[model samples]
Target: MFTSQEKKGIFSLSLIFFFQMFGLFLILPVFSLLATEEVEGATPALVGLAMGSYGLTAALLQIPYGAWSDRIGRRPVITFGLLLFAFGSILAAMSSNIYWLILGRLLQGAGSMSSPIFALIADLTRPEVRARANAMMGGAVGLSFGSAMSLAPFLAHYIGLSGLFWVITVMSLCGLLLFWLAVPVPDQDPVKATQPIGVLLKKVLKQPNLTTLNFGAFACSMGLTATFFMLPMTLKANGWERSDWWEIYLSLLVAGGLVMVPSTIFAEVKNKFRQVMVGGILMILLSFALMAWAWSSRDFVWLMVALYLFFVAFNVFEPIFPSLVTRLSDAESKGTASGVYNFSRFAGQFAGGLTAGILYHNDLPFLPLVLGAAALWFLVRALGFPNPVRHASPVEKPE
Candidate 1:
């Protein structure tokens, strides 16, 4: 449990991130189905493109957002991003066709706020304690996933997809209020503030272990995004309603959250990042395999089992990888480093969705698992990469 200040910081960060993620995921339960309806020309690939365009645009802006945060300070850049996201949400709500929804998600990603939020976190936390802060943010995210999955299915059923978009707009507006009113800025030490970006970049680059870590980030996102793209279709095809699908998603989410704490505690004691990554990769592969098996058997139980394991790995990795980034980065440029980490992730989100979309056009439920095999290969590459030298910087507050 956190003290009062830490608690507030964690909640504020979670709320901001929740609003952002809710904007992204509200359509997950039904968007693909909606896209294939008669009015939309029923092109699955285009729906994938529409769903993924936001990720593509967000990846492009991460580095710039991090730099902007460093140059101007975190609050202003974050606020600007949130406003842009709000604009995107409203535009999406009013869109007439799948093409217009694509435009809206793209604009939303263009104003992605993750980099700025992380930069503020880095500024606020001390070095030694940074990992805990990250854990807090990650925990918040897990909670948001559960809440969003549970709420979105019913909400989508009642209000329709466009209504969900409007709801996201309201959430974003509320985030703007919390960001402005609830968060506090840490006083920066000028010496830390003036470090040149290139200098910081070089310092991080010298770390030999970055390849594996970043690859893991990329692969993990790919697996999850692709899985998500398939999930609604999977459940529906298996004869489950949207409400039943939400129950499945929420159950797995809670199970994942329950496992994450113990896994991290064990990881810390053993210093087993390589082992952790390997375990997560293998588990993800198993989820895909199970999915394949379920399809063969046509059983909902196996499908649920696969999802439960998949999310456990996902929850472990989300916090574990970010903590590792904090551990490995140079003291001065944690902001830029985390931005790049998030960059790899959203980039993977784009590629993952497009890959599944194309494959989906060819074959339905089998696609996500086939891609999962490729993700396993990427993880193999990550495992073979070299390790970073320990800088032994004082552990700071979690970002």
Candidate 2:
């Protein structure tokens, strides 16, 4: 663990990451209801489009955003992106129509500097301690996610949906200002291996193992996006209030955190990377099947247990995959690989939402349909992955 004073800056960096994500996630549950007023003939598809458009924009921009961060410096590019994000938020907040909302979300997502943010972490931390820094970032993500889901609905009810967007805008601007004023420039520029983009792309994506990693990120995002669409609704049906669903998130994430520590240790120290990933994927698959079952019948306990299991799987795999990505590629292209991983995942988010909206539009149930398909698809992908752990692979390790 970093000393208290030393860790403060990173913690603040983590906080900046958290609020940016919070701004991203805050409208998820509230958007469908809000959309009825904003868009003419608003249907599930358009609603999904409005909701997910941000991720699509984020996906498209991440690679270039990453490269831009590399060229200039991390903070300047990130600040510009945040300003762009805030601009989008203000537009969304002031808009009365869905067209504006969609535009706002697209720009908002495009303005997100996910690659830049992670790049800053890469620039600041040593490789030996990088996993811990990455884990801290993951924790920020989880906390923001839980907090956003819990708070967004209540805030929407009281202040309206636009209010939530404005709040995020304010938060984003504040975060940007803090970064500009307080975060110091690193003592030295990040020394990086130079490679042509075409060559780097060929080397990383063409490698079978990293390709598997890309698919893994895809499956994980697809399954997560699809399944989470139903969980709150399921809880609502079981006499739980919509606002109270975060209790499950809070509880399960606690368990997930405890389990994650052991999983990371066992994977790294004991060098059981492949086995651990297999277990995480299997756990996710089981949770999907279980969620389907719970939804088929009104079984609250089963739903609760399945949610707990699902979050556990998410927490374990989220950090591991990125760390493993670091192992699978040259340092020159590690940033690029991370960008690809995020792009694939966000692409899944876009597809997952679009598909879920379509399935949900009909009388036949859809979250389960999409998630079940995603689960099976991922199981196949998991089977094809080569373990990236240094000790386990006979393949001449990641150079």
Q: Model 1 over residues 65-93: C-alpha lDDT tens digits? A: 77666666777888898899899989989
RMSD for each model, in Å, please? 3.3, 3.4
Clashes of 1: 16
Every model's TM-score: 0.88, 0.87
Which candidate tops TM-score? 1
Worst 10 residues of 1 by lDDT: 390-399
Q: Best by lDDT, which number?
A: 1
Residue 324 accuracy (lDDT) in model 2: 70
Question: Model 1 residue 335 lDDT?
Answer: 66
Off by over 4 Å in 1: 1-5, 38-42, 189-206, 293-301, 361-370, 381-391, 395-399
lDDT of 2: 0.71
Q: Per-residue alpha-carbon lDDT of model 2 for 1-399, expressed as tens digits?
A: 564433655677888888788887677656666666545666767777776777788888776666555555677778889999999999889877777888888888878777777766655655445556767778888788778877876787788877888998988998897777765555556545366656656676787767776777777776666555555555555687656656766676588788777787787666666778788878887887786687677677986787678878877877677667666655466666667777777777777666666665354445765666765666676675664444432122542
